[model samples]
Target: MAGQAGRSAGFNKEDLSSYEYKKILCKKDEIKTLEDKTSHVSDYELCEETVNDFYTKFRTNHDTLKLKCDNENGSKCCRDVNYYLDHATGIFKSSILNDSDKNKLIKIVEEIWEPNLRAKDIYICERQTDLDSTRKRSILQHLHDLKEDEDYILSYTKDYNNHLKEKWEKIISYTDSKPSSLFVKIENNSMGIVENYKNFLDSSDYICGNNLNDLSAHDIKISTDMDDFLTTISLDKISLNVEKNLCFNKRYVDMLKYKASNLQRINNALSIGVAVLGVLLIFIFLYEFSPLGRFLRRRTKKQIEVDENANDEIPDSYENSENGIPYISYHSTSH
Candidate 1:
């Protein structure tokens, strides 16, 4: 009984209120939740979202910078990250990032982009009908890796469109007139190649069978009147593919965009560089006429005087000679 009382009193020191105790518990819970989240260090979606959000901030700032600040010759490339690192890291002015750390970050960014590269490559994925044990193993392996019921696997393997079975058999089990080199491995969207439409000409079934359609379009719906035409393709794959690829190939195809931005940065570094350069250039151009330039002059005459005075004590010195001719040889006898 005494031990129980002591344990109870530990949290309720000095008659602590219920609210305070509850708040303390909640804080502990919050810390535990944060720890759990941090454990998933390889959460790709979370990392991608963070990068996209930060990029949005950078873009907003850049656009505002373009409007507010005016300097010539590619002030545009201030945040341009083509082949390198954080150009925007000037705010910290210090970096503890080592080579290994940078490489690690590059690898992470590449992981984020791997699916995109794969998806582009996957477009050219023509069905490799010449399935040895390898292709069969690859297909079966990926299918089994998915933890789903029999119905789910059947849905993909058998046919979503019951109409797919007939033509698919011919393509899947046929002589190799020409076999495709592209192999797709979408283990959560990080695999495949580009270059197709001709190869899968007759075999739309095999292309779509990969739980993905890249080389061929499988659906076509025509109206009874023959005046209406419609195409229904599984947009889910396309949309996810688009997200990964960022419309790399078809940028202009779906270029129309509308966005809302309340991008307000409370600081002013926009004109810092421009204003400094402008001021410095102006000073440079008008410097010679300014009073300060007198001190900055070459001091040719003063230098010459110093040179003469320096040589005055030396009898053989040319500057101290009668002719004052530089590089002239003269001989004189001293008393």
Candidate 2:
């Protein structure tokens, strides 16, 4: 029973009533002062009402942003979030004002919030490869200043736009080919060349597939029509032979390109081989006095001697004497 009594003491309901009484007294005095100062007006709208009106106007003006935001859930939250921002801050600020009149001044801030944001220095932290270290530092400094001043909404919006821009830029940049050569595993020799028209041609399929006839006559309709007209060759006219011809032509073009590339490789190899051979020849020439060179020289001299002797045999015009014969001209034939 003592333990239960101790637990009951911890859950004192009077403690809450005392705090509530003091808050109610403070709020009553604050409200009385506010009403007296604004005697010109009989009644004022609640903070929730003012905030709701502001949001309604904002959504009306920026319908697309509202739609996109709602679709993402982050935007839909703004519909109900107005009351929290207004009530929470206004209530706290109202209780702390030197006089109730000052609270009215604070409440007026909601009207100028969007305009004030527009007037402030907006910082966009974009991922730019071309940005130098100095520029990056400056952007960072601007971001820090905006955040420190509690001007975060504009900064946050800028950041969101910048991120979207970078993402789209990446998508566009992908249309430009990436060489695997930067990674050392894919050397320049093995790198494949990408044609500029590859993406343009590939994307044409999607562009042409849409039913442009269903669309109302506008700029887009006219453009799609022109493209379709130009590319629309008759199916009956497109014979198998014509297809084969196109295929053969494409293959021939590819074969030529391949041959050109192979020729370049062969030329490069030949150049390397020539350089290696030159170096080897230079080494051989420098060591001409070596034993191997001497042996080769001797062998060449003996071959030269043998070649001369083979060609030195006398012609039929030479006559012979008993011991040694002096060469004399004789052209007689014995019968």
Candidate 3:
């Protein structure tokens, strides 16, 4: 979903047209997040190196092997991932901005990013594309590299439907599209992704099979699981920069989003705990510390005494009177 929402949001024709222009809309919750992220880094000057570094950094992540760079021959001034990301924060910040600026960002990436840089940088490629036919351990997206998408895998960070279908094909074949222990074993082992590793891998490079693999009533169906698998993948939620998912430097964009998500989750849990604690503290203050508590306790004690006296045994003989008045004995024992 880009820009504003549906008719319930009331969007006129002109506004809707502009909003649909490859737009990236910032949700209300994400505004504070965007500001925090923007301030954490410096503004970057747009340049060829700025674009190139952004590309390289996004491509190099935990999912892929480190690039071979010679100080003299290779990238002499290649910036590290975290530092360069800050240096190139300008692009990452664009995710919150949905306008003609998004188009500008894409143009900048295409102009400066060397065509040679794909999702799999030869070594990264080897790791990404390996199918594990012979059981060679490697970084696998769909568990066979499934060369069908290799032609354009390097072209963009987003792993296209064809690419995911390749992986899903392998998974379904092994699972027979039926839910069973075998399916779970096959998915957990290979081809099927179970976690949101957007921080570690490119958003487009892999399709997480988590939603599908989760415990559900329906068994895996190839038509829906494979043909309609793209519906299961939402780049808007998964990709850090939706505008740039089609452009470049998606991994770093995704990383920032990943970190922010973790922080948000923590904040949510802490908020609940804090609310509970606050309620408990208020109760403690009213009961043990405040004057109201003391007054309430005194009243409660008097009420309890009254209740006890009210419930005391009725006079059996009426022989004891505090005022020393003579009392007559009742014949209750005989009755």
Candidate 4:
């Protein structure tokens, strides 16, 4: 039977890429189901099977991959006993419109399946190889299906693919590729993958069957310490910014205070200057109006006349007969 329909039938580049991605994911899941079945038979069944057996067993009904008909806890009426990849891919690729659908589908698959495959036994060599092939195929298909060139996304994917290829080469050179590599790169690039994975986990709101809850208190402590370190750095930045603002405020306030003080000083000086000028004007008025000033003026006039007579003739000393008072006599030459 074919798979169920997706939420939207609207065709877009994203939708097309999603469709292609779903097909690729269907292919990967099919391989995983085969890998799981073979693992039960023998460890060697991973690689010993012929190409004909590879196709045959992979195409068979995988009971291990089947969903329960009555999964009351999780199925939520999606009890078709079909894998999500098969269900989503069938609906998307029934008709090929664009690559966006294919990209979206592949992203969905990676978002869903990678975590599951990672939590499984990490030592499976054939399983790891299959996952690598699947990852490469997804990356290549995405590159092919992009409607417009997104340089940044393309560059990031290329870098990520190159990293995966390098890891695969390293693993293949030493021992056959281990199943752990399925998520090793992802875990190493946790910054990139964790947020997307969290979104996926939240979207389905389901814990993956393979997600392990094996972290001890010590691991949690380490994680907490790392979180504290980041928090401390952020706090330090905030504190520095606050301190800078405070210092700027203080400087601005000081400047205002200084200006106020200067203005006060100027006002005080103006008041003192005005007072001094008033006192000087009062002194001048008193000097002009006083009796002493008039007497000084009269004395000055007599001195001036005496000096004029002295310039004309010599002055002789004379005494009054009755009082015997010494006096200066001035002779004037007739001109």
Best lDDT among the predictions, by candidate number: 3
Report lDDT (Cα) of residue 96, candidate 2: 29
Model 4 alpha-carbon drift over 4 Å, by segment: 1-248, 307-335
How would you encode candidate 2's per-residue C-alpha lDDT over 1-335 as one tens digit per residue?
00223233233222332122222222333322332333333234433354345434443433333333333333123322221223223332433234453455445544443333221122211222221322222222222222232332233443433322321222222222242111101001111112222121122111111222222211111111222322222222224323221211232235345556766899999999999999999779855967878888889999999988776755434555545765665669999
lDDT tens digits by residue: candidate 3, 174-239: 222232212111222112232222111223444332322222212111221231333332334443
- Residue-level lDDT of model 1, residues 198-242, one tens digit each, is 122222222222332231221222122211211212223434553
lDDT: the better of candidates 1 and 4: 4
- What is the RMSD, in Å, between candidate 1 and the native fold over all Cα? 30.3
Per-candidate TM-scores read 0.19, 0.20, 0.26, 0.19
Q: Identify the candidate with maximal TM-score.
A: 3
lDDT of 4 by residue, 33-106 (tens): 43334323322323334322433433333222322212331221111112333323333332242556445544
The count of residue-pair clashes in candidate 1 stands at 5
Task: Give candidate 4's whole-model lDDT.
Answer: 0.33
Clashes of each: 5, 0, 5, 26
Pitting candidate 1 against candidate 2, the one with the higher TM-score is 2
